[model samples]
Target: MSTDAVLVRVRALWEGLAAVPVSFSSATGVSVVVSPRALICPPGWMGVVALQGEAIVTAPSSGAAVAIRAAVARLSADGLVDPDLLGRALPLAEVLGPAALAYVDGDGFRPVSAGSLAVERLAVEDSELRQLLMVAGDQDAAESGLDEITSPAFVIRDGGKVIAAAGYRVWPSRTAHLCVLTAPDRRGQGLARVAGSAAVAHALEGGLLAQWRARASESRRVALALGFRELGAQLSVRLS
Candidate 1:
């Protein structure tokens, strides 16, 4: 559960949160292409994925910018951290490109935290899974792999329709990359947390590290409620 472990998987194109290896690194640098085989990446752009004191840098024939080159060299040379130097060399927005800081549970398993709402994992065979995906507007993951979401894809229903959903995609590291969705109409009802909690419970049962990476402040709140610790920020960025 250490941050280093999480970063290792991510550097290898595996998502600690998604619990799946990114088919390819789509989050390429703004101007360079690190890996030619990566998906959704243009022909050229430097890319960097940094976390847990490790930096994974990819570029076509190395990056053109001297600042980025030096910064990457520094990260490679220094195993420890100096927040100021890192801040100067690798600003998150600049380096990670609109990246987010997140919390990872390294010490112990966090219990589910949603209140009294009932949340059950969605079954691919059930019509509710499709309905939940439609209501939550998350057709990409939930819809494409309804059966693949079996371990802990959960949805909370209101009047027999889905209102909120949460689940984890398992990774090679046994980390559960959590996904939570709630219908716009159902906001402020605490249903996101409720559904999320159930998914975490299932992740714990399978002995997965529950990783919560938060892009929005609202997601951070839910992770905190679930007892995840705020680790330092990491970026999968495209260089400008």
Candidate 2:
């Protein structure tokens, strides 16, 4: 199928799956689906496929086709893909099937202190933060349609540079997904917890529930710290 056709099919599948309670996010038009204990993606894509138990996929409308096998490997590592379903999706070997691997499961959300971090709402004029997000991972935050809304962003700054960031992607249901990112050099400093709390508080202020798909351990930690409860796990697969 043409790339456009493939994109349409993949997005359709994502929409269908997201209708469930599982956590999911999309960046640059690519979708990342997270179950309670795992992460998954479509057949072809690339970039920070997984982060702190979360997953990211890339499906650019104009780039060369991504490796289906690599994409499956990323998803399978978290046990997000179903081998049986994957086999049916791609009848051809070149098309690749979902890969499977074992992963560790842990905490979800717990309570956190809102006063520990400096929180600020983001605006379109905040180009520096936007730039920081765009390069933090394989996904580009600036282009993620996040800036188009009045969604608030909470950030942690060290000196003049942003050390960490968190924000929400509000959906039509008055629910908002929590997205957090910390600079590689700034991790291990409790920045995630601080920024995450700010994001959660913002969601609560807006009367929206904060949600995210996390890796087993990270999920547990964030959920426990943020007062998020476990929903359930999800299994996803892509056909060739």
- Per candidate, the number of residue pairs that clash is 13, 21
What's the TM-score of each model vs. the native? 0.63, 0.52
Note the Cα lDDT for every prediction shown.
0.54, 0.48
Lowest lDDT sum, 10 consecutive residues, model 2, at 99-108
Report the Cα RMSD per candidate.
7.4, 12.0
* Model 2 agreement with the true structure over 1-240: per-residue lDDT tens digits: 233333333333334434333223433222433332222333343212322244333332122223443444544323333445434433333322232111111222344665646666666358867766666765434323345445666777877777677777764445565667777677667777888777777676776645554544653565555655443333433323
Output the lDDT of residue 31, model 1: 23
Model 1 CA deviation exceeding 4 Å by range: 1-45, 52-54, 60-67, 71-97, 101-107, 113-115, 124-126, 138-150
RMSD of 1: 7.4
| lDDT score for residue 112 of model 2 | 66
